[model samples]
Target: MNIEANNTVNPEVKVGGQTLRWERQTIEKLLLANVREQRAARRWRMFKTLLWMALLAALVWALVAQPTLPKTPHSTGIGAGHTAMVSIKGVIADDGESSAEYILPALRSALEDSDSKALILLINSPGGSPVQAGLINDEIRRLRQKHDKPIYAVVEETCASAAYYIASAADQIYVDKASIVGSIGVLMDGFGFVDTLDKLGVERRLMTAGANKGFLDPFSPQTEEQRQFAQVMLDQIHQQFISVVKQGRGERLKETPEMFSGLFWTGEQSLQLGLADAYGSVDSVARDVVKAENLVDYSTEENIAERLAKRFGAAVGAGAVNALRSLPPLR
Candidate 1:
């Protein structure tokens, strides 16, 4: 029995077939999952892009198309006979809310209104720029003469420095007994950083086109000549302030050594010194003094659009600064 049995296993066995099918199914599932993940990532990127685009659009709209609220009849000076009120409620600066740009228009509107019996300046501020206050004072006098309307100043909380400068223009000024009423003085304030910089080992390098251009620089020591020059300028302005107060108050002002010495006084003390007329309020003055019980505010109010535009501008400015800081430094 010369029978040679050759034992051979088939190449395409059932076990091998099963293993190949399993690997194929796993690869198909992995490919499907990868596609889904890519789609999700793309969608998220698109959403973020759209969100940024919307924010940019809104900022642009706020900047370009600053919409304002519709004026009511009272604001337009078209109402019944009333006491016209204009507010002076903050620092009197050229760029401030209490600036002449805003205040003058409201004053003119109030004075021009035929139905408005009288004009009242509702004042509550610690004062600021003398130049701005002077402008307002001049305008107040001119408008009072032109319109033949009685204008009164009703002080609240404070009526000092540049604020008193404006109040002086009024026919009469009323105040609360406890109100702070005067600081008839001018000042130029600053800080000296030369000593601090010396201690910190920092050098101040400044260039100016003119001699006095850098005279006010804090890092540089101020010359005696500069100091005297500044004092003279201040004195001249002080004289002007004194002259204005004298002219406004006339015989009503009782001259005292401390009166124009930059000393402030209480409303009661101011009354004694002729700085204020009497104790009264806006309502009382309107009802009793002007005899116009109705009140109409003719003040220029900051609108919502302006506020939003300002905030948006600030945000954009901050974002720009951050982006600049994050950039790679130049070689």
Candidate 2:
């Protein structure tokens, strides 16, 4: 009587004839309990695995996705078999690829790397920011002196304006014969809306803390004094560009009258002008110079969505933390 019942009727479930029996209800209850226990255990294990997987994913992202300044490497670790190259592409702005943030780290890495036989800079830009270009040029010279490694600049399709300015600092600048180069001049461009504003019956009531503070404002008319002052500034910057080109190119620069007149030149013309060392590409540098034959670009890949998400999340989290912290001390 394993069955729990008040009735006299037998609870035995006999299958075949010979009174073979077991308490049916009790067995069914036990089986259901065991099934529930197994299901619950399986669910717990699955949950644990999911938790561990999530933790591992977070750890991997932290280690691989984040961009940090590379530490300088020892000479022996870099040169004999390895070569590190950096690509300078896009607009050379303060925050972009040609910017200090993007370039300085790579330059520092190359300078410190002992095993890197050659530090190659792949140039493909129309050029921007003379100051940024000059800074990068100074760094290239410093790095070259410190590391004593040859730095090569390879112009892909175009290396005009500030791009050429930066490339001139390289030990050898190579370009494709059809590549665009030159445009070594400073320029200032702005629009004047004073006449348009008068037509639109609007007034620009601008006040300046200093007499020349708003000298170049587009809303104001250009005065002779302002024009002269602006020329002085442009000349100062242009002189800097000229000085760098002279310093970097030495006797290599074959500047005709048009070379610094803000006009670009074809790759062959650049070579003729001594603006470039040779008319070849990265393959030439690698195969002919460093003898690496193969190249690897270790630049950190940027993910816009991930960066935005992280920034937004961090801002929100920081706000919450600050709000909590700012509240009067919790009793």
Candidate 3:
């Protein structure tokens, strides 16, 4: 007696007119096939799940650990606590890495950071353009007044001229005893090769509609009038720099009238001149005063790709400039 699982007829056997049918066995075979399919499906699902988990872990590690390309080796201060240090490098030019665009953002981050108790400006510039230096100084004032966070300027190997202008805005300026400081002045040095060109039978043929169109061309000799004019421009810039420093340092600056004559000073002489607030390195100030535990450098880390792009762009720009200069005079 055989009965199918779906419709059992409680009979010993179900037979057709010409053949007998094994219904129970057929039903068992169908059930076994379904069980095998389900088992294979479960194994496949487990394999897919394991693969997904491994891929996810690899992705997580890549995201959380943003790696940096190796750069010039230098020791940075590492404390036990969590405070960020914003470091400044190179000349403070309107263009290039030292521009206000790069500097002000770092300063703003440091000032607005809730985790940082105070901010440090690590300076190692020989100075650059007056405009760039002034822009930084203004931003520093605004940040200080807004955030009320103590800002310290730590001068490294050297901090002169425009660098000093920016540093003066710090709540207190710290310098290594051996650091080069001062140079509170402005200068635009250049060479005129017109006499040498005449000796070599070369001509500097220049024509301009404006009287002072080529005011300070390096290939042309300057008349006394032009020299006086250049000096006046330089003097004006120097005066502006002096005023900014005085405003930032207040009575802390004890400089003689000759300080703005474009002279450089050692870090030791700087303290007495009121150019710097103290003579100490970053570690001394951070550990002794701010009490920061860990120091994190917020400066942008340059990668190989970024540097290569910069070089390529610079080369293209230089080529364009040379091409334009080589063009014949417009008739």
Cα lDDT tens digits for candidate 3, 1-331: 4433334463334343323346666889999999999999999999999996876565556444543322222223342254557777887776556678777777776656566677788999999988888898899889889978788899999899889988888889998778898888878888788889989999889987887778688887677888899899989998898898888788987879777778878888888888888877778788887887566666544444444556667988999999999999999
RMSD of each: 8.1, 11.5, 19.4
Answer with 2 or 3, whichever has the higher lDDT. 2
- The local lDDT score (0 to 100) that residue 316 gets in candidate 3 is 89
For model 2 the TM-score comes to: 0.72
RMSD of 1: 8.1
Give the alpha carbon lDDT tens digit for every residue of 1-331 in model 2: 3423334466444344334334776789899999999999999999999996876577567657674545555654433666678889998898665687778887787657656777889999999999899888999998899878888899998898899889989988898889998898999998899999999999899998988788789998888998998899999998888888888889988768887788998988888899888876777788878888656564433445445556667989999999999999759
RMSD of 3: 19.4
lDDT of each: 0.87, 0.80, 0.77
- Model 2 — which ten-residue stretch has the worst lDDT? 12-21
- Using lDDT as the measure, name the better of candidate 1 and candidate 2: 1
* Candidate 3's TM-score: 0.70
Global CA lDDT computed for model 2: 0.80
Error of 2 at 283 (Å): 2.0
Compose the digit string of candidate 1's lDDT tens values, residues 210-305: 888999998999999999999999999999999989889899998899999999999999999999889899999999999988988888866555
Task: Give the 10-residue window scoring lowest on summed lDDT in candidate 3.
Answer: 68-77
